[model samples]
Target chain A: MKELSLNILDIAQNSITAEADLVEITLNETETELELSIKDNGYGMSPEFLASVHDPFSTTRTTRKVGLGIPLLKLAAEQTGGHIELTSVQRSVDPENCGTEIKAFFRKDHLDFTPIGDIVSTVTTLIQGFPEVDYVFTHRICEAGSEKLVALDTREMRIILGDDVPLSDPMVLMWVRQTLEEQYAG
Target chain B: MKSLEELAKIRERMQNKVILREGQASTRVAVGMATCGIAAGARPVLNAFVEEVAKQNLSDKVTVSQTGCIGMCRFEPIVEVFEGDNERVTYVKVTPEMAKEIVEKHLKGGKPIAEYTIGAAEK
Candidate 1:
């Protein structure tokens, strides 16, 4: 994906594309563990959709079905001994629009070092405006001896810089990486 | 060992803020989501928008959305600003910091930041 964040963002973006009303992205970090989870209230997947989600050739839209994003996510998780899960809800349309809920859960508990997911900031940096989608990024940093949580607003990055910088800037990435390291290692 | 159950508390506090109300249609900040954009790291850019909009309580004024490649793959991770009745302003090579600038200058000041805009490149 564009970056780790973009991959996550792409997933979240998919929810909005699916006409989802709300999407939640949570990044949980602990000294020995770091977890990334994103959920959405969009039209969930179906048996057909699920079967095709990772097919690299089958996607929701007819335009493009490169299923690289999900596979990449799974690969990222696996790299750190983490897991990925997807659950979908089928929208009946008659009721409150039900759909499948796809979840990709990643957990790496046996590693000598905490396998941190390096793509947290990428997810946070992509969506600066166009507020239809609500994204939450939670970093629960667990150090060797202590644990703390750092919560970042996706919007503040924009308000502070005043439109002079783009999310792709190395400085911005530094800030995000530093923030995560500070919470995880500081 | 925090469980999803604690998320309920989060839901309670968040509900008080009415975080789920789908505001009336408003201007949206759309990003290119093609394979190229993804390869160039468009996710963080998107995340920055969603997180920032929610944190600043701009959920009513803006919405972060994604679309397929606008055929400007040369400028991967492109961000487009579409305000009411105005021509779209396209920003290329956006980083999280630049995204912040957009929120401050474009979203808040209502002026496009020239340094990052395509039109500004000529000068």
Candidate 2:
């Protein structure tokens, strides 16, 4: 992926495929470092599968022999003098706490650090594609002794929308885009 | 800044309209969004289709959704258009510009662009 946001989108797809009901994407940016964490309440992978997740050739997909999402993300972080961590608890192993979390750290000062682009687009696209699921997105940046935060939680919107209005409604999506843009602007 | 109050108003307005359209759409546009597809720039292509479908007021007839890899990484950024139960057209190596044409010419006009289909790409 050219942009870190694209990687975020790709990784989130894995959660969707695993049938996650709730997905949380958080970004913390400091003067010298950036961290991205994606957590999903889905049917997490088995230990054997998790062990091979870093290998591009090991994939849950039967269609192709390679899955590049995790590996590409690992490379992107490592290239920026950072690292990635992944943890999962399969539904079979722990039904009460079955999910996956991926955390990637990047050095902001590193020359190879990829830019986080169009995150607003990513959040909206995820909602539009899967209206049944809920998502929480938060981005925090701390610089020069100041901090700015932008956050959105779809669960609150759902309560107001009730079961009648879908989150994917075009009007709602337009509002979401505008709201996030305004937050980023401030 | 936009607030939740605005969303509440929208919800009130959409509630009645949504109840009437609670059925499957006639056409489905599936964009490949797997890792390979993203690496080859599928995001823009998917966004284009979504925007065009909404702009054309075809949202009720056509639903755009994302799909995993169809084992066609070589043909990254692919799109599949399914009409009803029988017809499905697979377009390979799609770009955002091509997405617009597909939406306008193929989707709205009821004629698939022959040149962009997998058959044409193979030939």
Candidate 3:
């Protein structure tokens, strides 16, 4: 992907296909490294599927053969001397915190690594598209060894609306977009 | 920065329509969103479709969704529109601006823009 946010959006779509009702995305950037993590409370993949998840052509969807999201993300990470980690757990009968988590670490200043582009738009689009799903997006700017955290939890906002209003409502979406912009901009 | 006041006004205006548009859409607008698509700038294309559909108040009739690679990585940022029972029309190398036009002409006007279709792109 040209931008890291685009990869995030694509991976977030995978979480949606997995029927995740709740998804969490985190971005942590420092002088040396940029870390991205997307966690979903969806139906997890099998051990066999997770083993070869890096293969671009091994896709479950019959519409097309190649699944470039994860494989590309892996390549992007490795280009910067970083790596990707994917972990999943199928939901149990009693229900543990079962889901999948994909994490990638890249060199923050690598010339070949894609820039972090339009993350506010990325997170908000997911929120707007999936009205019923809950998303928690956390962005931490670690500069000069200090950290600044910007966390957005849709569940909290939903509760504030008395659980009737969808987050996709125009005004609510506006609020969400503004909130993320302010976090990154400030 | 977009003002919340403006959005609040839209919220008031769209309150009824939002509720009315909750269901399966007759026209499914699927955007290619795999790695190649993203590399070719599909995120904004997808967002443009969503924004345009909302702008035209065609959310009930036109549904926008993302899909994986269609085995044509060369034609990244592809968009497919499936209307009723007719075969889908795949548009290749779509941009954010083209997304708006497609919505205006095809989704709302009931005619596909031939120049932007896969037939033109392939040939």
The alpha-carbon RMSD values of the candidates against the true structure, listed in the order shown, are 9.7, 1.3, 3.3
lDDT at A41, model 2: 90
lDDT against true structure, model 1? 0.61
| Per-residue lDDT of model 3, residues A1-186, tens digit only | 678888898888889888899999998888888999999999888888899889987777777776778998898899988999999987752256779999999997778788988888888778866778899999888898777888788887765654345677655876888766776666
lDDT of 1 by residue, B1-123 (tens): 322333333434444444444456367898776666777766667767766765666766786777677766667679999998999999988887788878877876789987897676545
Kindly give the stretch of ten consecutive residues in candidate 3 chain B with the minimal lDDT sum: B1-10
On TM-score, the leading prediction is 2
Comparison by DockQ, 2 against 3, better one: 2
lDDT of 1 at B82: 93
In model 2, what lDDT does residue B112 have? 96
> What does candidate 2's lDDT look like per residue over A1-186, in tens digits?
789999999999899989999999999999999999999999999988999999999987889788889999999999999999999999888888999999999998999999999899899889988989999999999999999899999999899888888898888888889999998889
Worst lDDT run of 10 residues, candidate 1 chain B, spans B1-10
Ranking by TM-score: 2, 3, 1
TM-score of 2: 0.96
Q: Ignoring the other chain, what TM-score does chain B have in each prediction? A: 0.83, 0.94, 0.83
Name the DockQ score for candidate 2. 0.77
TM-score of each candidate structure, all chains considered together: 0.54, 0.96, 0.84
